[model samples]
Target: MTQPEQVTFPAARADATVDAVVARMRALDAVLPARDGVAVFNRVYLTVTEEIGRRLRGGEFPDPRAATALDVRFAERYLTAVDADAAGLRPPACWRPLFQLRRHPGVRPLQFALAGVNAHIGHDLPLAVVDACRAVGCEPADLEDEFEHVGEILVVLEERVREELMPGPDLLQLADPLTHLVGSWSLDRAREAAWAAARALWALRHRPDVAGEFTDRLDAVAGLAGRMLLTPLGHRTPRPR
Candidate 1:
């Protein structure tokens, strides 16, 4: 859509080293001053991915190959979306909000980050899970451990991002639009939902029509939630004390 003028984060196809991933994310992050929402989300995702890699190295996953397969598959969904965007084709419905609002002046960085998380967890993730199961030649149940572990790490990192970017003072008590928006979406719930959706998709794999409809509905709902999260609450004019 409109060439996605704001985001230029390159599409990643083949797997790369952690350093390479970090560099790609960091390069985009350097322009945060420009308020690129995609970059903020990319950084968050990168951090979570790095943590997952560490967990994989530490033998935390029962089946390391499955975990790696799942991670890579999950990433491909997003990267493919990016590639679609770059080609002036529509990315997934879920990613549309971030691409549209990446440069919105009234949207805070945290909102951008959370919206991206919502889109990924609610939409891309279930599909990723299905892709992983197929690639690893297993069922959804087989990769449950990796899925849950990744979700846990993601939750932790999301909290860290909030703390780092949250405006000082009592945000919760201020009746802030952001506080309400944040309440409307929960990463924990989104992760659980993704798991359920993944199982459903896997079960209906033989029924492509049913599976395709389910995925479309999921993407649209996630996109709606993301748009709500990215709603531009105009900046308050500071009172002259």
Candidate 2:
């Protein structure tokens, strides 16, 4: 399949069922270049969505309704970003760096994947929690277990992705710049920060101004980390398959 110049998801589609989100991701996988930075992350995220869908179908979640709501809401954030980019509007700061640096040849696929992870975990996940809460008419504490379960799965996936994308042992010298760059960000730290941000946002739900300000600050900081993650290494190496 030829790669689409941009992935577009309508607002209506944002509220589509989790199966729809899974199908959308599958379509993206078919169209996007495997080596493209965004595509790299897309593949990882697709895996995650597939797992979530599977669990939902298997009746694994104690509260399937809440889980589905959380899953769909979480997915909509990513789709919204893609739609914004397609329309030439700026996506959230958390996502802008990945979209901007996506095509840079010098950036490794691993860097792109991790940068995407950074943005999603740091910014989108917290907001998704709030979205899910509203959709389910519940509080953050009610969905805490679901949140942690999803996050734990992501952590495992991140480890596997790192192993899969790791450069050859010889290429990973201690002094390599990639080492330092990748080392600077930790997913554990990002997850902790996300939980804190979610609690803060939930507490400020009645105060739009303060909540918006907090979100903007979070976005800016996550974007900065993403920018750092995408720093071109000038390696001239083709992105790993």
What TM-score do all the candidates reach, one by one?
0.88, 0.92
Which runs of model 1 end up more than 4 angstroms from their true locations?
Answer: 1-34, 169-173, 236-241
lDDT of 2 by residue, 15-128 (tens): 578888888778777877788787899899999988988988898888988998888888878877877786788899998888888888889888999999999989999999
Checking candidate 2 for backbone clashes, the offending pairs are none
Candidate 2: what lDDT? 0.85
Model 1 C-alpha lDDT per residue in residues 83-154, reported as the tens digit of each score: 677678898899999988888889988888999889888998999898878877999999998888888889
Candidate 1, residue 226: lDDT: 90
Residue 168, model 2: Cα distance from true site in angstroms: 4.7
lDDT of predicted model 1: 0.81
Top lDDT: which candidate number? 2
What residue pairs clash in candidate 1, if any at all? none
